[model samples]
Target: MWDSRTPGIPDELFERTEEVPITKEDVRALVISKLRLREGQSAIDVGCGSGSITVELCLQTRGEVHAIDFDQNAIELTKKNLKKFGVSAHVVQGKAQDVLPELPQVDAVVVGGTWGDAGKVIELAVGRLKKGGRIVIDTILIETMYHALAKVSELQLADIDVTQVTIAKARKVTTGTMMLARNPVLLISATKP
Candidate 1:
């Protein structure tokens, strides 16, 4: 059902206006740089919003992708986005903590947005990964970042790293003056032993 031009999606996905929407370009680059996805490797995107990354996962790797989200509207949007890109992925509508138990082990996991249960979800995600598997998570809140760091430590993951991404754009303050607008993101990544 999922092909290069087919977008596998539903109609009831979630909608978020406050956050910057992830684009295909973002997904493609991230998958290549961060995940280094290989052919036949499996991946899961927890809290996948609009399937931007999920669809990219499908495209970059020949492996199957499991895309999950709690919001029905976001799930639907993910479905639409996947179909629009002609990629195929399994889109699940449910909480990550609840669905992790049902999925088979995977090679990589990406947590795009945690809905308040980051620690528990990360534990489960790490547990379900194959040995040497990778986990990448993103957070805007320092509290969440700390919690994830602790969890990775508890899990004994190696090569732990946290990076801050700042994007600044120039906005016109006047005809000759401009101001810089900044957006920041925290990315944490680790590898299971």
Candidate 2:
């Protein structure tokens, strides 16, 4: 079992200058571990948000990373994080489904926030993936999870794995600590046959 309590990249490194969503360090750790990234293998991150995942991917792999998001502010924030970490990625400010076709074939894909386009993005990503490549999706919505699972199955991807993670943290109260539950997230992963 992997513990996300400690992340390779500390959460404080990020500068949340703008109002944009960022993946928590713990969840980012799990997603990175599950992707099984290799050195020099290309990866794409759809809905990169604040580039928390993008920065981690860049640090974890020597391969090229294409970070895409529909929000320009999110793209800028991603760029800021990448710069802060002294890493690089192709940050594109556009809808993932529209920009995915322009990206090079990749060995891995991470869908962190699809924005109601999980099915379409997964379908496109799988098609653009190389054989033996992996796709990992993180969704907070059951509907999105179902859509990703169905699409991965329909695409005939192998080694399908789905996990629901409910994480709680101990917050300090006046006298002692209390358990504070974060939103549960579903992780779906598959490999191109």
Candidate 3:
């Protein structure tokens, strides 16, 4: 079950009724804050589910936003969300590894999902990034974080950082009693040299 308090979804999103495995508001905020996006810079959002981060990227930056997802349902949801949010972003439906090579190089790339091909995705994304461009990836597992770290080392990114975010909320356990619930996330960001 998904937490109702989690923001970014709208009533029209439920019309399609396809489950989104994970939605991290912290990741969204971190990507926006860390990227320090500038006007007229190009950006791409890989595995862009429901276009939440994609739309946000377009809104926050003056550059063009390209959002891609392989799942048909996710693509539709992303399109719906983009329209609902009134953001202009290019939506593409395809695998990240395959579609990435076709698009023009960009200033920043955000990996929302990699389908377990983190190494290949990162490599392609880094290759496409302009000199000194940034790459931001969100991983929920230790294994994925290790993979990202390895890729950063392999690419020899200039500066690298891995951050873990934990959000705790108060949960009602019983009458007049409450407990703390926590959700943890891993964020890995690097810049191409």
Candidate 4:
């Protein structure tokens, strides 16, 4: 696993618009580390908002990456970002629960943001995952966290773990450097038994 302290994607690499939230580099690094994807191993990125995480995943994995988003703008941004990075992926514009079943079984599934149906998405994703495949979910709300946990239990995934990443960055001030706290995000990860 790459050091979490090392940056994954610079904040400036993406063109953010239309309130599409891009994953910060720190959290992106955490998710990628947990994924542990290898060359020629396929993965899916659900709710790929600004495609920042999707781009990073594309760079890491030589296999096919399916970036799914319900929003049209997010779909376009993901395509643009992939083009900019000179990597290839199957950018799908649709809900995860619908798109995942159509795609081939993958080695990894990442739920970066679920649109209120965390359990259903988890259920669908786990069904499509190969044996011993890894699933990493990023949840910001308490409700989503609990829902995902319940699904993980129902699925009986092994090596289940959760990490809350609360990052603070240093900013230049007139007098000295100051710390600025970013919103905390929970990373709920597990592997198929």
Model 4 C-alpha lDDT per residue in residues 1-93, reported as the tens digit of each score: 232233377778777886788889889988989988887788989999989888888778768888899999988888888888777788888
Tens-place lDDT per residue, model 3, 15-108, is 2445754355555777766665776888999988767777667766757889888988888887877776666788889999999998888989
TM-scores of the candidates in the order shown: 0.82, 0.93, 0.85, 0.94
Compare candidates 1 and 2 on TM-score and give the better one: 2
Better of 3 and 4 by lDDT: 4
The local distance difference test score of each candidate is 0.74, 0.86, 0.77, 0.87
Model 1 accuracy (lDDT, Cα) = 0.74
Best by TM-score: 4
Q: Which 10-residue window of candidate 4 scores lowest in summed lDDT?
A: 1-10
* Candidate 1, 122-186: lDDT as tens digits: 99999889998888887778888988999999888998888877655557665766656444667
TM-score of 1: 0.82
Q: Which ranking of candidates, highest TM-score first?
A: 4, 2, 3, 1
What is residue 13's positional error in candidate 3, in angstroms? 9.7
Q: lDDT value for candidate 2? A: 0.86
Model 3, residue pairs in steric clash: none
Segments in model 1 whose C-alpha atoms lie over 4 Å from true places = 1-32, 170-182
lDDT of 2 by residue, 10-67 (tens): 6677867547988778888888888888878889999999898988888778679999
Task: Evaluate residue 42 in candidate 2 and report its C-alpha lDDT on the 0 to 100 scale.
Answer: 87
